[model samples]
Target: MDITFLGTGAGRPVSGRNVTSSALRLPAARGTFWLFDCGEGTQHQLMKTSHKLSRLERIFITHLHGDHTFGLPGLLSSRAFSGGTTPVTVYGPKGIKQLIEMSLSLTQTNLEYELHIEEIEEEGIIFEDEQFTVTAAELEHRVPCFGYRIVEKPVSGKLNAIKLQGLGVKPGPVYGRLKQGLDAELPDGRMVYANEVKGPSIPGRVITILGDTSPCENTVLLGVGADLLVHEATFAADLPDKAVEFGHSTTIHAAEAAVRAGAKKLVITHFSSRYRQEDLEQLADEARVLFPETLAATDLLTVPIPRIVEPRE
Candidate 1:
């Protein structure tokens, strides 16, 4: 899994940064991509990356703010012309369906694929499949907003081929059965347990992406144990009061949440346009004071999800 930052600016678009949009590319899901937010000019941003509009399986809108969702209508309309035939599902706040429908109706845009929109009313597990589960939590923002936690299911361990060969077990369907955690009967009528030759299961990865929010307990809870915490740092460290008043967070607040949540790494975006590139680097440096594994995201920046491995004895 990898994340590509499309637009990392806050409130509006600027020269270097666009607005709040990011793409989570899941290589395990046949290279399909899931969009986190669709800010203005997001379609153009997607054009810069290797991602295809047809490969966008789902979209998760953080809020109804223009900076977060203004690009929805255009992206939806453009997808039809870009060979997007697969059905797409959108999950967002209560008014998201109305927002999309109004835009499509006003523009008289017809889509080639079936569009499914789901409005989230409260916080819980909103989506779940065999490989992944997405949970939503209400976040502290000026309007109704949410933070999403995507948890990938654990994967099975690999079969020990060398061990099987040492045991004189010829490679055949018996290896397949053992890999499925079933015991295999040998030619000598001895039963070989699967656990004896199987390594430990690999832990699943967790990613938490929050909307424009103030530092709150819910943010901490949503980001707990996440491999990457994508929080908004719209202000510098010195402006705590301004951050709180505007219902946004400073770099310090983002670090605080990372510390409380025990997140492995923090990647902050949605920066206010007032911050220049050097200033954003300074903000990231300051955040490192509290949480060392923090990165300030810029447009087109990609981060691969780190795998978890058990400690050697």
Candidate 2:
């Protein structure tokens, strides 16, 4: 699992950064990319990268802010022209359905695949599948914003080849069966055990994507133990008053939340247009003081979640 920042800038697009948008790519799971927050010119930002728009399985909006969601209509419509026949789902707060309908309705854009929209409120587990689960937590912002937590299903550990060989098992399809905890029926009618080869499965990665918001206790609760925390830091540590006034978070606030949540890594993003790339170091230093795993996010910066080896493959 990995997160790529498509647009890390706040309010407006900067030279080095775009706006507020991100894409989560799952390579091990056959290269699926879930887009979070379709900010203005997201397609244009994506064009700068090697990422394929057809890989977008779903899109989750943080709020209705233009910087957070102006690229929806174009991207969604262009997918059809690009031969994307797979279904896509969009999730957001109230008025989201209406917003999408209005955009498509006005443009009279016909989609090649099913387009589903869901408007959410309150905290709940919004999405789940065999591979991953996504939960949303209501965040305090100017609008009904939400933070998302993505937890991938546990992974299986490598099979003990030496152990299997010792048991007179040759490497073949049988190895897969053993690793899957299935008893292999030998040609001689004897059963080859799974414990004789497979060890254990590893835990999957956890990632938390914070929406625009002020520092709140729930942020820590929602972000706890996440392998990576992609959070908004609209201002530097010195501007706490302004952060609160705008219902946004400061760099120090993001770092403190990461520390409190015991997150493995903290990626500070959604920066205000007022600052320059040179000034990002000041904010990053403040976060590193609290959480050793700290980084100032930039456009297309991909944060990797280390692989782990679970019993349930």
Candidate 3:
């Protein structure tokens, strides 16, 4: 899995950054990408990247803020003409359904594919499939905002080819069955056990993405043990009062949250417009004092989440 930040500025667009938007590209097997917080100009932002509107399978809106949702109607409208024929689902807060419906209705825009909107009234497991599970929790924002925790399912270990070969089992269809944890008997009447030969299963990755918020318990809960924690650092450490008053987080708040959650890495975005491109490094430096793995996000920055492999028992 990989994350591509489409826009990284807060409140409004600047020359160095746009607004809030990010794309989570799943493996090719999934054949689609999920969007988080589609701020204004997000469609324009995607035009500059390899991610296409047609491959946008799901959208998870953090809140109803204009900077986080102004691009939804335009993007959804463009998808019809962009070769998007498959159904699309959107998950968000209570007002999300009304927002999309009214916007499209007023514009008289008709979509070619089915559109499903889910309004999240309660916080818990919002999405779950065979491959991934997504949990939502409330955050301390001006409006009702949410943070998401995505956990991928564990992948089975690979078959031990050397061990299988030693048992007089040549690579063939039998290898497929053994890989599925099934017992297979050789032509010579020798049975091979899948568990005895297979390596240890690799643990799935955990990713936490939060909406605009101040430092709160939900932030730590959603980010606990996350492989990648994407949180907003909208202000510098020196602007603690401003951050608290505006319901935003400072660099220190973001870094401390990552430390409390035991996150492996941190990517801070939603920067205030006051900071220029060069100033981001200093903002990141402040956070690095508490969490050295923190990185400041820029537009179109793609971060790859590498799989964790476990050693054989």
Candidate 4:
């Protein structure tokens, strides 16, 4: 799996940073791309990248802020012209349906693919498929907002070819059968066990995305031990008063939450346009003091999921 940060600026677009948008790519799902947020200029951003618009199967909007969803109508319209035939599902707050309908109607634009929109106000599990399950939680923002937790069940462990070869097994359908945990029988009535060939299944990966929010109980709960925590750090701690007034977070607060929640890595984004490149890196450095694995996100940066391995018995 890989995560691509399309835009990370908060409120407004900066020269280097665009806005709050991210694309989650699941390698196990034929490179399925799930987008989060669609700030202004999102279609242009997609045009600049090699990402296929058609692979965008699901789009989850954090809130109704212009910085978060202004690019929806344009992206939706362009998807059809850009060779996107598969139906797309847009999940957001209640008024999203009305807004999308109004925008499409006012512009006299239509879509070729089935555009499915789901309105979410409450918290809990909101999405599921063979690849992943997404849980939504209400967040403390100025307006009705939500955060999403994406949990992915991984594939079984890699087949140990050397171990199989040592057991006099040739590479063929037996390897597939062993991976499927099926024991094979030989002509001599010998049972070739799957356990003798396949290793233990690896643990699933949990990725939590924190939308614009203040320090909240559920945020910490959902972020606990997350492989990656994408949180908003709109300001520094010195501006705590301003952060509270604006319903945003500081770098210190965002880092502390990740530290307290035991997240493997902390990715701080949704930065205010006031800071420069050096300043964003400084924020990441500040987070490193508490959590060594920290990243200051930029547009078009893709992060591959860290491989996990279990110790042999």
Best by lDDT: 3
1-313, model 2: which lDDT tens digit per residue?
Answer: 6788999998989788899888888865477689999998899888877678887899999899889888999999998987788899999999888888999999999999999998886788999988889999988788889999988888666788777777778878887788787889877787888876666767878889989999987789889999899889999888999998889999889999998999988999999999898988888998788777899998888777777543354
Consecutive 10-residue window with the lowest summed lDDT within model 3: 304-313
Model 1: per-residue Cα lDDT over 1-313, one tens digit each: 8999999999999988999999998856476999999999999999999999999999999999999999999999999999999999999999999999999999899999999999998899999988889999998889999999999888888888899889888888898899888999998998889989888888899999999999889899999999999999999999999999989999999999999999999999999989987787898998999999999999999999977888745
Candidate that beats the other on TM-score, 2 or 4, i.e. the better one: 2
User: Model 2: clashing residue pairs?
Assistant: 201-309, 201-310, 202-309, 202-310
Residue 51 of candidate 2: its Cα lDDT? 73
Measured against the true structure, the TM-scores of the candidates, in listed sequence, are 0.96, 0.92, 0.96, 0.92
Error of 4 at 141 (Å): 0.8
What does candidate 4's lDDT look like per residue over 212-290, in tens digits? 9987877788788889999999997678779878888888888888988898888999988888977988888877887
Q: How many residue pairs clash in each candidate?
A: 0, 4, 0, 0
Candidate 4 TM-score, true structure as reference: 0.92
User: Per-residue CA lDDT of candidate 3, range 239-263, in tens?
Assistant: 9999989999999999999999999
Which 10-residue window in model 2 sums to the lowest lDDT?
A: 304-313
**lDDT comparison, 2 vs 3, better candidate:** 3
For model 4, name the residue pairs that clash. Answer: none
- Backbone clashes in candidate 3 total 0
